[model samples]
Target: MNPNGRRGVELMCTGATSNSSWMKQLTSASRQGRHGRVLHLFFTSLRPGDRGAADTHPAAIPTALRACARLGDASSGRLIHGLVLTRFPSLASDAVAATALLDMYAKCGLVASARRVFDEMPRHDDLVAWNALLAGYARHGLPERALTLAIKMRGQGLRPDLVTWNAVVSGFALAGDDQMAGDLVRAMQDDGFQPDVVTWTSLVSGSVLNFHYDRARALFRRMVAAGNRVLPSSATIASILPAFANVTDVKRGKEVHAYAVVTGVEQNLTVSSALVDMYAKCGLVLKAHRLFDKMAERSSVTWNSMIFGLANYGHCQEAIGLFDRMLCDGARPDHLTFTAVLTACSYCGMVELGEGLYRAMKEEHGIEPRLEHYACMVHLLGRAGKVAEAYDFIRAMPLEPDCFVWGALLGACRSHGNVKLAELAASRLRTVEPANAANCLLFSDALASAGRQDDVVKMKRLAKRRRIKKLDGCSWLESP
Candidate 1:
């Protein structure tokens, strides 16, 4: 028979007896670079009367399943699972096929189904199965379950390799269980397993998440001292560099920068962005600007970091200017970029510029203004004694006004002594955030300012009844 005729005949054998022939055809199709066709042919062969008894081969179903997963075709994956159940339910007992199924389910975000397959496996005793389930749990944000599963795997006499340990450690780190992640690292060491780059990177990420810059630094130091020969990636440097931004110790931040240079990651986009942020937050905007300018390729995140850093340091004009430069450079501004720019405009009391930018954000850039943006606008209007305009803006917001938005109007009301506006703002504020002590205090202060002593007394009584303790105001100074 010709190849086409043979393929047609192959498609007609759907029963279990055709297992061997199906396996051979699958191999031939794969070798010929027709993976998708191979999957289609396999499933086509399994349809109703076409399935041959030779299709009972243990490896045929898994081969098809793997192909479906590789294609990322969820429908194909489900069809293969159905084929497995229909033609050869015994194939589910195959450890390799079960592992493949677990992987397919996990990749498709069907973790619950993956877990079911894992639980139903008669031979759930393998490390591969355990690792697959643990990885699924981690990927789906069930790190706690992943951790528990790891312990159970160990208890059940499965010797987890470095890959397994890395998964568990990374899972704990992502879940914000830094201490448990650290303990796992220590446990791995105790078990005579030398931690790899993945182990260190996971720990570093955990430190970054938990704001433990010092611990991250210490881990990096240890990695260097050991001379284990694994270099930190740009992503790793990016992850830890931001923590050093707010750090009082510029000396330490400089050390990390030096390391980035030594590791040849200084030109890395993420690392460069982080370095800019760190230097800016350390009151070294000039240095930040110098680094930013030196970058050959800058991402939008890089621009945002520099713009936000400038805005945060009270350099509103420069921040706005940088924002314009970002646009000139054709870097698209995300929501965060607009928030920074709007905040800068508010702080500088550039109401006209702020309003223009706000309108342009929606009209020109298609960016929807969020509550924070509205709050900044309200504050700007209130500062200029445009209380009525501010109130109107709140009412006209695309979404329901949040407590912060209402509080902005309340603050403006207090500043202008607009008793009616103040009462309206307060009533809306109370509805949105009833237990907010700041809102309550603002309302009471507004009542007092409006000469409503009886109302003020009543508000104070309500405040006392709610046991709302005033927050202490504090400030700090950093030596540059």
Candidate 2:
């Protein structure tokens, strides 16, 4: 069904009569990221009663398995496994073919199935198969299993290599076991394998994931200061940028940006996208926009960040315009895209447009409205002084409204002086998030705004009885 894959296979099959030629085409398509083409070629080449097609194409089996691994098409991988069992049973004894199957299952998160393939391999001495299964366990949050497997592998006299060490280290790092990950790094160094860019990037990424932004930045600095032995790759740049973005540390962000530009990774898609996001979160919308516009390629992340930046800064129309351009450029909008544009609509009081897009999101784009989408709608209608309409919208919701939905209604009721609806919204919000004193505070404010001093006093007494105290509000300010 993939048009490019189908077209590529059809055009190249003109002289692919021999089994080797068919394998060349399959592997070529996979390497080109045309995994769909590889599948198409694989299945189509298996003719009716053509046992030779399956039996002779031993090389094609591993290539197809690799494609299945990349695509995460486990069902197709199973089908190929079945074919190998029925038609090309000799492939079951081939180490390369069996290893490919093991890797495909592992990458698809089928650790058990990958283990079965690894165990059933004609030879257990294949280092590549061991690493594939080890990585599968480690990558899937079973670092302990990976370590045990590595010990067993070493018992079999197969020395652990750089890939094996990095796999275990990455597993611990990704699981947020920084102490264990560091110990593993030192251990690998003792084994005469110096930590490379993958090792450092894993540490940096793990720190970022755990919200240890300072530690992530420090590790990045250490990696950079390690001289020419290992410089920050694009992955390293992309990983550390989020730490800066989350903290709104534009100074460090710009320093990293300068590094990226000097290292010629400025044009890399992921690095550029992260830069756009970093600038946007730092409140430098103009700088974000400039970087966004200059990019030759923009992903949904790039577009969403720029749109969100514009919407957050009161440039609602510009945000909406950019969304239109995104559609015109044939970029598929995801849920975040609609969230960004709906936010713009709410900010600019474009209630009708928001409604249309909400419907289009479900009908045209097939993206079901999530809780955030419902919350945005309530905000759009409520802020437009249509408090009654917002209440009706909440009533008609397919799912039960959450705290954000009722909170939007309560906030709207307060702004528009709808005391009755405000009380209802606050009650529902309290039921949804009972511990949040902010809801009670807003409801009390609504009562005060409606000149109901007696009701406000009663609410205060209720709050005191319930032991609900409003938390102090704080804001993050840019450093001087």
Best by TM-score: 2
* Runs with alpha carbons beyond 4 Å of true place in candidate 1: 1-133, 148-159, 212-233, 359-366, 427-465, 473-480
List, residue by residue over 1-480, the lDDT tens digit for candidate 2: 111121222333344445376667877898898998999988887867655654555667788999999989999999999988986676676677788889999999999999998877756787888999999999888999999999999999999999999999989988999899999999999999999999999999989988988789889999999989999999999999999989888888999999999999999999999999999988899999999999999999999999999999899999999999999999999999999999999999999999999999999999999999999999999999999999999999999999999999999999999999999998898788988888988999999999999999998888888888888888666545
Candidate 1: RMSD over Cα atoms? 9.1
RMSD of each: 9.1, 5.6
Model 1: per-residue Cα lDDT over 285-396, one tens digit each = 8899999999998987788778877887889899999999989988888888888898788778899998999889999999888878888899889878899999888778
Off by over 4 Å in 2: 1-25, 40-58, 73-89, 454-480
Query: Could you tell me every candidate's TM-score relative to the true structure?
Result: 0.67, 0.85
Error of 2 at 23 (Å): 4.6
TM-score of 1: 0.67
Score residue 140 of candidate 2 by CA lDDT: 89
- Lowest summed lDDT window (length 10), candidate 1: 1-10
Q: Please state the error at residue 239 of candidate 2 in Å.
A: 0.4
lDDT of 2 at 139: 87
Prediction-by-prediction clash tally: 22, 0
